[model samples]
Target: MSSSIISDATSKVKNMVAGEKGRKVADLDSVSQTVSPDDRITSDFGVKMGNVDEWLRVANEKKTGPMLLEDSFSRERIHRFDHERIPERVVHARGAGAFGNFRLFESIEDLTTAGVLTDTSRETPVFVRFSTVQGSRGSADTVRDVRGFAVKFYTQEGNWDIVGNNIPVFFIQDSIKFPDIIHAVKPEPHNEVPQAQSAHNNFWDFVFMHTEATHMFMWTMSDRAIPRSYRMMQGFGVNTFVLVNQKGERHFVKFHWTPELGVHSFVWDEALKLAGQDPDFHRKDLYEAIDNGAFPKWKFGIQVIPESKEHDFEFDILDATKIWPEDLVPVRYIGELELNKNVDEYFPQTEQVAFCTSHMVPGIAHSDDPLLQGRSFSYFDTQLSRLGINWQELPINKPVCPVMNFNRDGQGRHTITKGQVNYWPNRFEARPPATAQEGAYPEPPFNIQGIKARTKSDKFREHYNQAQLFFNSLSEPEKNHLAAAFSFELDHCEDPIVYERMSQRLADIDLGLAQTVAEMVGGTKPEKQTRANHGKKASKISQVEFAPAKPTIASRRIAIIIADGFDNTAYSTVKATIKAASALPFTIGPRRSEVFPAGASKKPGNGVQPDHHLEGMRSTMFDAIFVPGGAESIKTLAKSGRALHWLREAFGHLKAIGGTGEAVELFKLAFALPDLRVSATDEAIESYGVVTLSKVSPESLRESITIAKEGVGFLEKFLYQISQHKNFDRELAGLNSQVAY
Candidate 1:
């Protein structure tokens, strides 16, 4: 070939590559079905129907008669509608999912040979499901419960699933008692009063009785249970697994996913109110983030302990309730997982996807962790009943690689195979199993010699040391929140035995915690500590310790409250600034339709549109609030009790607040916060996370905005405060309690 011919060919290939890169990969597009504009409605078997609105019936003179049994079209339609819903998962039923790609920026080939983890060139397709474990399908999203963080990676070799949770540990160490814990935490059998809460008599009773659950119970009581959003929480594979290298070396491993936005959680009051104000708060947060191109991402890391050193730890490595403390076994960052695409349809993709712990590729293998052993069997068994044996055939659960097996038809089977021989060792040597050298999973060579008895390792019996370590690692605010959480939960337990025993159990973790909760819940105060705390603190154990490497307001929702006669220039500048920073800003006014600004004509069409009205949405829905300058707007807002309450409540919640011109006075009038600094004349001031400016200038605002901690202007200070998420100084300073919302 000539040089010109090769150059033309190369140009065409380059164009093709660019097109493919721009094209969104709908992996489930092949299975997607839709109604078309050119086609008429049809029955199940593809017969077009003329009238789908009415039923075919035997008609009499001037009156309708009995429906005809021969109307198969109506019958089929009704039948399909009747079976539209499958049974929701026994747990993690309320969920939202998205599709994304997993990329390995740094390979771990020295530790594991799994192509998805060891190959830097592959962009593995992934579907991640975020869920609340204790809720039913219709339950609220902000309930205080463990969030399920299950991810399925479709690699070239096979599908690898990490069925994990936001919390690093579980309530029970063994899976055999899974049903008992679930039943206790669930609504009581007789009344079924509380829908999706763990603060009840039976739950506390179980906690006190099952002393092994101490460590995990601490996590559940913390703010981690009420995450601000699914995008801001961490994920952990609770059970330990084995990683086998190409050289045949083995290591015990646990998986971790650190969010790019950092770990953050809602205050208890915010969480409780959001449950009613917006039941789908987290779900909407996720969908809108992806829709707006602010994709959620997490860094994938693993903590590995060499096989020879597994038995060197004080606690059993296989214990599900314990954590391999970051100080002892640091997590090695490896790759990244990002959710870049929203699900096309909820039912076919999010709801039908399934994950099993037994599903492994070549480099990963399950450990002898008792919880994992039972889960390996339990997950696949549940899918058999929920999705049938052919659940693997579902588009969302199917692998990117080829699958060949003797497993054949069951209910809902979609595969059509050819050939007479169906079993292994066929005459033509068809579908032979891959050898060890061919990237097949080879079980690590290890011997197990033990009696077949129901028992745990000796170290499993010693559970309080790590529990105490966790309590010692918390910050003062976190500890107080945990104590308040325990007090509230135990107070709900009217049964004296439940509250009393649990209060005493707290002494095993921390003496101060036991006394605090005991006094609040009417339990006998422990005179002495049950177990001495080791005072061993671990890094990355507290939520406050996890901060984004750089300050960012990306994807955060800010509410700009405005009314008639608001400052148009200030409002427009603030809105534009928020958008440029990649944050969401909503115009909220007295009415959702339109609100005219000062000096504007009183024409109906000459006004700014608001996304929501003050009466319809509360301040709890937003991460921050801003009020632009306008004399009439401030006066009108001062008269509205709800508007004043909004500011007061936001202050009490430790949220960032900003005001300009006369709006700064309105903020002070609402809260009666004389100590809060406000701008005087033409300057600006920031006090207790509240930013105020007496004058407004679009050009000055641009110059003032900076990313540094000490911002040069009001806009800069306000945005930086919002990026910090929450100002715990107010709550920790004991000032929030002084204000009545």
Candidate 2:
């Protein structure tokens, strides 16, 4: 596994940047491949490292742990490549981006003077990027990883970037060790294995060694890392930031984005399959939903800790890895945000959209978290290096409001700044005037202490309590997902040492969690946990608790499969009924259009339009499948393996499958089903995703329509069930003969 992963990791770099850098840079196991994957392997100067593995292996054995003078290729490559790549951000590097906007509801005059949140009418454009911290850009989205949920609000005042993630806490206390944690989590340099993931030896070794990552690892292994949709996941500003009110009173605040639809995640099985089926799944879903008019929304909330009580909590407010239980610090919802737009161009809008922790408006500012301070300096500098010093001038990074400043001129300066004088004290009063009022732009008056030295806060030492809290809070299935996630990641580790170390760390958080993981990972579990005060628990942290009290099929898709010589009216009614319920229905048949001839002439289609033909659609693509009544069509469909295969796939996916008319005969013939739940009338596919419609009322699309409109019985029962994502537990029944497509 290590060897294969190492080769794969090397190949990724080959794919990303061979041509752009002029030389073929090989030592890089980086994720961003600028060049094509299939492009010929080349060196920094376009030379090939033919049979690289054998060569390196042979040389290493020859040296026997020491560098030999004769191996110039290995020496030169590792040496130069050591300085080839710059440092990745302290957090949130492996992320995907999209363009959107945030419209305000009501002004929050009581909280802060931040223009973006205070203005009720302005529609500030934004580019939101969601990411995984431990993985590279090439990693799977399903990996149990912290999702970076950073949004840059191009407000009228300036750009206010709320850099956050799905998980509330972070891995470390201070910025001093930020580099160390990142280095440990990133692909190890010795062999440079493990592309786009943290289930490796070096990373686990670091976790066990440092012990600060306990809280974060718990989050990493949980289901939150494998979100069903970007729209459904919550976002949090990990650190404690400050929000100053109009009166100039400073309040230490934390930000939250509770999705209006509530939080949901993909089952681990589904997430893994999706990674292979479509690595671009989440990205595609977000884009398609935005395109199809299903705009995602979230309510903005803040938890303010008074300046006087900053030191009152048992745990430090500034610790990135610690979370203040909502029970203690209630989330006061301030405003709302809606992402109604898609990017015009991915490269210009999504790719160039830079989110810096330091991008703050006058009212909002950073805290004392060492990591955040490093971020303030890192982001702009990294952008300068990556997109040039004038990257802020780029359209996506540019502030919505006009930018006026004396600072000008740098590499890649696209705009030609006019005027002879760039200084503020110019004799010409033609320059933009500054507001004199303290409310206009006053900095919070806070005193600084001590000499400039590297020191961490004492509160940073408590890491396991929140980890325990998070683990203790999960529902049964959610906890199972976490254990499964740990197993999945660690199972990929080739080194037993790595697995052992990781297991010890896991044991520190939760012994059962560690034992379960180690059993699967082929390592010994620690007898006990090795952490300080194991802290409190909360019910609300787990997303399962947030399942909408009432389930609605608003955005769900149901497919009504049909064929020629079938009771067309029954199929049409069911289709129409689902539509009436405000759920989407697709008319699927043997072909794109299933024709119904009148009387004896009813043969092939005179002409019929299907929402999607069987070929264009699949059971995996929809929430449920229904077979309309038609004796002739039913026999034809039964004979054709495609029809049975369609239902089988739907069943395998745990989607609702219902039949009416001769369609009931097809179900009876479907003896090749496992754990079949033939509802007395209607059955909800528990493993799959919907309410199957059978016993169609041709005379009345009304009964089904009644069932549809009311979110009761099978509909609501399986609503949350289907939303659970992939049925990893499914054990399929065998086919006597393989069903043909």
Candidate 3:
């Protein structure tokens, strides 16, 4: 052969070796590429192409003929577009995710040997996905459904996934009934009605039959179902797991993630309105908060029971439908989780990420919890069908630590191990498994001797105790909301039997609750309780107890409504005060165009430009509303029915409302409640979360924004009310129902 031919053959062989060995990749950023105008369009195989707009065809200069099958570029483009989507998760189909870090504030070395929980010096990287359980990918975010809170911790040892939900308990005790509960709550099979809702006949009937679902169903019907934002909700690892220490001791553990901002939820009417006004409300809220540098943080806690004391609980610790009362087993907060980064791309980062209950690092092992066991199996199997056998190799799912194994050759396989041997204990001792001493997972020895049977423990049968406890623990406003939720859901059940049976089932928890819902839904009102109420209450079960130690208005959305002639001084000062407190302030005007102040010209660009117009966004999208004073501005707002409705709706929803000077008269006119009070002088007065000041000055408007229980100034009082989240006192006093929006 010639010398040139031999050189070409040698180059080809070197390229093949490089391909099998695989190029070294340092991190996720190294593999990521940014699209720019400077880069040329190319095929998947990296061939630059021309004339992408037209297909290869046999035609004259002006007329085009049938496209040719030999057009590789067109064929490749069409093929890629056809298979762009993978099957979404059977549950948690709609979700939003972010990247963050988990830091151990207090080492819990005695409880477990896991480094993420024991090493206070280390910051473990994490990815958290917040989702709705029953919704499809296109469903609205504000629907009344259980929220999925799954966190994947990419620790040094391996990836540990805490597959959990906003509510600690699940709908069923055992995993065998998982399909039944999901099917019942999902859109009905016959006509597929009621998408992403439990207010249906089949769901009510299923809960009535399965008594174990009583506790979880009560939680679903509470305000917890409609969270205001993903950042404001608590997350719980519902299934029980085992934590083993260096001393070879085991303890039953339940995980908890409490938000730093405290738990808050939208009123039913507000939630319902936002579902139609903005289906991506929650998703946008999360992304915007992170983008604005108001990173959401959560306290990591664990409720632990010693191996010998596991059987001491009144309810089975392994049951998925029950919660260990905090009064009995207190939570020990040891770490903190803060999400600081948003994903670069939705498809590659958020959508492709997969979590498994079976993914646990060393020192953490699965308990014999029946529901958890089946979940561990089901999650892995489901990923196979959706992402194929080599799902773990995906960048979003791959572990940070080295992965050396004999397993190879599957669809979408990216790793190319350069080796002749692919088996363990081979002549070369290739890819041998690590022992427990070599940072491997250790299995604790425990005695297990039982006959194979399909039965739960006797304690699991006692379901009404905790359900009653949860109801009794709630505040009066919370109780009313829960009852109202029950009424609304049952009313949606067209079948008489489903609603009637469910109404009677409520008597098992509380007679008054059963009777209240029964009357509203037209069911037979129960005069007596079916089962005597234990009247037991537990701490931390009610969301009111989750309030933060210090009040904060950070990241809250406050809308400032104004017209053409508004008080520029008060508006500008209040907006600055809100921003200084780290809260978001938006201007809502009659038009998106510039609106003039009291003295400014009404010409183009001479006044302030509103962020959004009145009809463009509703009061439901904000945490509070404020209207600055100006006689002309107040007169304009007073004459417009939509503007009056905005104030009334905010009042009915129990949100904080504020006004200064002439705007105070607008509030009085809009509310029109004889019982409602407004400020008559320069001093600020807050009644039922309606803070108003009859007069305004630069000094008065510039008062320090302190969030005290009883704020002394106009700005302070208004900020304090915003921090409180909602004015439940108005609802309890029956004032909220008196106004018409």
Candidate 4:
């Protein structure tokens, strides 16, 4: 029986290796080629090259000298390296991308005839790129700015690109003002002092001058600007488009991508600090999630309004600066987007991929949205300068379906033609256009009568009403954060006129919000409202409405603090429990070297080594913390100022805290709250954001966290506290401010 089992295992191993070597994924990977082992260095022309590290020159054995210019290979290598870079994108220059599939949960054939949306059996491959709008390619990912969430779907019909952002609205309504807004927000050309920031004189000046930007500015000043992770924020197709059904019925639509993990953001202080500590925090977070098989996902939702009722709302449906509120037109979720694969290479995949607002399939049409109309032309035109005329020929941007066209060779063109005729009107009828019945996009039969003039509708005149609605919908903590964000931005604007004017504009939204910001920024507080607020609120505008369907610690980071003479049982049990819940557990000690347990003998290999030291990481880097008990360990931690500060900072940030045995006393000493509830005499107790257990044994520590209505255990309660994200009550009760870091 043992010999038969070994033979079967050996056969299985051989089969696995064979499968790994023959796997063929998407068409992009099928076309990919790699350098072979045992191959020598060769030039672009495939000629074998020698001494690639140094130029072929006349030199002595003892000393090197460059006296000859006959080294063609060395010159060629240097010449290619000099021209290796192409022009970076003017906007959304810094980004990361991934490959995913879109699966339609419910067919929307009634709304559109698009195959990708109507076919539930087909999985449409997609490429998504997340970016920051204003930053250059070298900018930090944690800067306060608008994030770009652009997606390109490779469908059976054609390529459909959803050029969107994290925010639903934009700063300007007319596309003619695109250059103006971009130039104003970019580093001021005169000095170029601020790198990837909106808190500058020119930016504030533009905000106060352009009345249409009031609504968008309110969103930028909110916590949405500093998202916790790209996987945790919402995505919106900022521009409105038209969707036509099989019966030629038209409806105005806005696209939305709601993350499964829910919308979350970092504190302003934490965001700023992260920029210095981890410039690529967002990029690393996304790559690591996919690498660990924790695929990120979002629900595809669309807000639709019949074409007959386009003018029924106060704001124009075609205005890019306005949003069709969910209260008026509810979002219909019909599909799921899951990113399961990371890019194989950054240059040929992530950086080279392009998205055009005009690219669409049948049943999808562009609205006369002024910004979108201009973008349709601008996106294609800019690609010519950045990627040359044959940009679409690049493997990353090519569609999976066959593309046959008469438009022939430009610079860097890869396709080879065999036919003599290259024009569309050739007698051979080569590359003929497809009929409407053959998956071709048919233009809508709509007549135009208006004169060609650069103007906007009268409905665009109103801007502050919805802005007021957004401000009023925010919860108390959200409102306070908004006020603080505005004050922070205005304080950075040294120009007195710029900040003073912005402060006065805030009164149009809410009097209290304006007063709060004005006081913090040292501006003159306005005595009256600039306009009536109209007192309105909209659901789903606040981030609090996006909590996950089920509470989970999956992908969460929990830190375990320890030192010499730590409780080995508690330490090992907590780590095992955290891993079983799919959460990551990290050990932090006074030193990275191994430290002996309380009951362990003083031997070489009988100790635990921590992942990091006390000074190596901060409380802000984790979601929660756990401290195990041992008399010597607790005594040492109580006296160490850095260890004490870690507890205070975590408590002030409203993160979950857990302790056992004498560790509960260490927490009390750090917060100096003797009156706070703890497990001094009982088995377990929880108070504020802290959970403690005085007497811990292997049996009690082995207890599982089960979610139930009654008789909940201490472990279950601790995990629930982490799922809540934050404890606002700690700040409301004047507890966080009392504790110092």
Name the best candidate (by lDDT).
3
Off by over 4 Å in 4: 1-25, 31-41, 47-50, 602-605, 673-676, 707-711
Worst 10 residues of 3 by lDDT: 20-29
Better of 1 and 4 by lDDT: 1
A best-first ranking of the candidates according to their TM-score comes to 3, 1, 4, 2
**Candidate 2 regions with alpha-carbon error over 4 angstroms:** 1-99, 132-144, 187-193, 430-433, 436-440, 450-453, 525-535, 557-570, 577-677, 681-694, 703-741
Q: TM-score of every model?
A: 0.95, 0.77, 0.96, 0.93
Q: Candidate 4 has what TM-score? A: 0.93
User: Candidate 2, residues 496-611: lDDT per residue as tens digits?
Assistant: 87887787777767778878888888888677766543556786788867755444455556777777777766666656656555556777877764466223364454545677
Error of 1 at 161 (Å): 0.3
lDDT, candidate 4, 1-741, per-residue tens: 376765565565455446543533276676576778978899988899877877787779898887467877888888999988899999999999999999999988888999988999999999999999888999999899999999999887778999999999999999889999999999999998688899899989998899999999889888789888888889999999998999999988999999987888877776887788778888888887798777889999999999999889889999888888899999999999999898888888999999999899999999889999999999999989999999998888887776667778789897775555677665444455788897789797997789788788998888888789889998887898899889998999998998888889999899999988998998899899989988889999999999888777666778999988999888888888887777778999999988778988868789888888889888877778999999999888898999998899888877889898889889889888654688865466768768888888665676477532232455666777776667777766768778985
The parts of candidate 3 lying over 4 Å away from their true place are 1-26
**lDDT by residue (tens digit), candidate 3, 1-741:** 576765665565456545534533235445578889999999999999987999999999898899999999999999999999999989999999999999999988897899988999999888999999998999999999999999999887889999999999998888889899999999999998889999999998999999999999999999999999999999999999999999989999999999999999999999999999999999899999999889999999999999999899788999998999999999999989999998888987888899999999988999989899999999999999889999998888887766767898989998887756677675544445778887888877889998898897888899899899999999999999999999999999999999989889999999999999999999999999999998889999888998888999999999999998899989999999999888999999999988999988778877999999999999999999999999999999999988998999999999999999999999888988887889999889999999999978677787466788866899999999999999999999999999996
Q: Per-residue lDDT for 223-293 in model 1, tens only?
A: 99999999999999999999989988998999999999999999888898999999999999999999999
